[model samples]
Target: MSMIGLVDCNSFYVSCERVFQPRLCGVPVGVMSNNDGCVIALSNELKALGIKMGTPAFTLQPLVRSGQIHLLSSNYELYGDMSQRVQAVLEEFSPTVEPYSIDEMFVRFDGFAHAPLLEHARQLHHKVRRFTGIPVCVGVAPTRTLAKLANRAAKKIPAYQGVCILHAGSAETRNLLQKTELGDVWGVGRRLVERLALMGIKSAWDLAQANPKEIRRRFSVTLERTAQELRGVPCIEMIDLDEARQRIMTSRSFGKLTDDLDEIREATRQYGQRSAEKLRRQNGLAKAVLVFLKTNPHRQDLSQYSPSLVLELPRPTADSREILHAAGLALERIYRKGYLYQKGGVMLLDLIGADRQQLSLLDTPQSDAERQRSQKLMDVMDTLNRRMGRDTVKLGMPTPGAAWHLRCAHRSDRSTTRWDELPKVRAL
Candidate 1:
């Protein structure tokens, strides 16, 4: 019988960091979020230090000063490259590989006997680690949901040795489900877990045993599908991972709260450029741009003003110039002078396929040549940015000491991607 296998990287970001700086492997290492505001990824050693995900970096200053914990700014470029390398290795193992997330992939295992399937999973796990220097756990089961559960088991159970296979009616599968909490299940959230607890479904096994009809009656079809999935039925379909998003948003918190409109405008313009890049990457166009600003909500003593405005484009376009113009107009309308802004963002709304653009007779006709020129310009800009680093060719010069600049003091080198930053071997 065909089975699904989930290959999940263990402590993906931390592992990526360790691949370059092996010293970070045994240390309590953490990858901070944008602006180094909070911890987003942690190594197993860091988790043992009693620091949870999303713990503010400021609170961990004592640990850092004491040399008990190490925090590094998120190196997204490095992580993205590492993820691609792992995916390339995974493609060698299975023909049909579906990336569930950056750190997880679901691959189909067809026409393999039980023993061979398990052996193949073990080999795939070893090969990924050997080729990419990133450790991964493989979980095989009849359904994706079960495969997810099996993957969790592979991570948690020492006996599994990083590879687990679970058949639907197997005693091992039932024991694993019973041991798993409802909240730990793939589709079950905190709210759903609370609701399930009240319904006497405190574990994955309980949910698996619940009546599917009753689950639908009390909750949504989604929950019912989850219940069915828990019972080894595959209700979820793996859609195209490369599908265009309905909307694109790019935003970041300022390094420091600022009331300067120019600083905010610079940040907004950059965000608009990023949103337009994302829109074009998916071969889509936006009809409008939304600009939003927020004051620091944590400071209740200070007056707060959050404002947002949306400006529609003359016509749907992915041109950064048009998007940035709309974003500027929207920002001017929404920006408050007296309030210190903590964050600002641009959202590309009402996205449509670039090929499906509707022509408007009322608007001045943009000649085909003009449209081609615009596209070619955008293509060139994107290519240069991707080949080089971001902001290598920017629309406008960013002001020095811009408040919107990210605070990443502990960032590591982009050793893999940048030639100048590659690791050097010193003769001792």
Candidate 2:
């Protein structure tokens, strides 16, 4: 049987926290976003307490003061390291592993027909948890869409034991499809759900039974493929690890409001630098830089302004300084005074492989020597930063007293990543 498995980490951000602070395993916890502005991740206990995702951190002050809930700041480095460990363990279980996100992966079980899939999935789940200290749910099905439904069931239902399998064309699988709501399907958004509702297709089973030909005509070929996949006909294939990104962006809200144009410019430069670093790491060059500035929308008495500008480069380059220069120019043009700026960032767009770059007739490309020299410098800088710490070597990004640095007031140690911050065991 041809089956695919999706391993989804359970409350991934929260789980990463619990790995070091084992006491937090059963505690109600919420992970706040940049500047501790809003809740982005929650533990099961937090969800049970009716603390909805994206709730502003300020509003939860009363709960925190009463000692009813625990809060942790977003620690991307730790979470990112944990994700790699989990992915590494998962790679040992399947022939092909496709990363869906930071906390989700799809595995292709093409030729492993004789072995029981559910048992294999269970073993894989245990191995990941045992090795990485992260809990996960596995969903197994013949198609990715149905596998998504099984994953949902694995997480939502009580009896699945973190592994849910829906055999192709089985009555149990049909019942599961019938049980799933139309809006809950992966690709079905509110607009699509409304349209599907008008056509009496109110559930996954309804969509599965709909005419694929008519769906392709009335809606889109994408929706048709989804419907086909829901009925166990695979449409989407596994994406390769080196899949190119459409865009790269880095943004963050400030710890406090500011009216200074230079401060906002500096923050935009920071974001642009990071975005460019990612571009170069991926071996992609961008033709445009996008800058955006915004003020707090919540403050009714204050003047609110949100402006964005796109700067097209004369020559596409992955050089951080070049990207920041364009981003700074764009920022200077769109930035407005008087309004208190709360956030700013940069985006890289119109990206293409740097190796296969095309030069414009109006301008000449950089000499091979210069390009090689720049690449070597960037490599050395990146190496130092990774070996020492973030910003161990910098290219003009402000180190101390920087507003772009997040408000991680409740951050935990980088136990696994940083040797200086590793947890010490107590001899009992």
Cα-based lDDT for every prediction: 0.91, 0.87
Worst 10 residues of 1 by lDDT: 360-369
- Return the top candidate by lDDT: 1
lDDT of 2 by residue, 1-428 (tens): 78898999999999999999988878899999988889999998999989899999999999999989999898888999899999899889987888899999998776555346767888997999999999999998889989899999999997999998887789989999999998889899999999989999999999999999999999999999999999999898766669789799998888788887767777887788789878877889999999998888999889989999999996778877778889989988997778888888899999999887885565435565666777788788778877886667766746466665678999999876677888998999
True-structure RMSD, every candidate? 2.1, 2.8
Residue pairs in collision within model 2: none
Q: Residue 16 error for model 1, in Å?
A: 1.4
- Superposed model 2: Cα runs more than 4 Å off: 238-241, 304-314, 329-337, 358-366, 397-399, 425-428
> Tens-digit lDDT track for model 1 on 85-167?
99998888789999888899999999999988988999999999999999999999989999999999999999999999999
**Top TM-score prediction, candidate number:** 1
Clashing pairs in 1: none
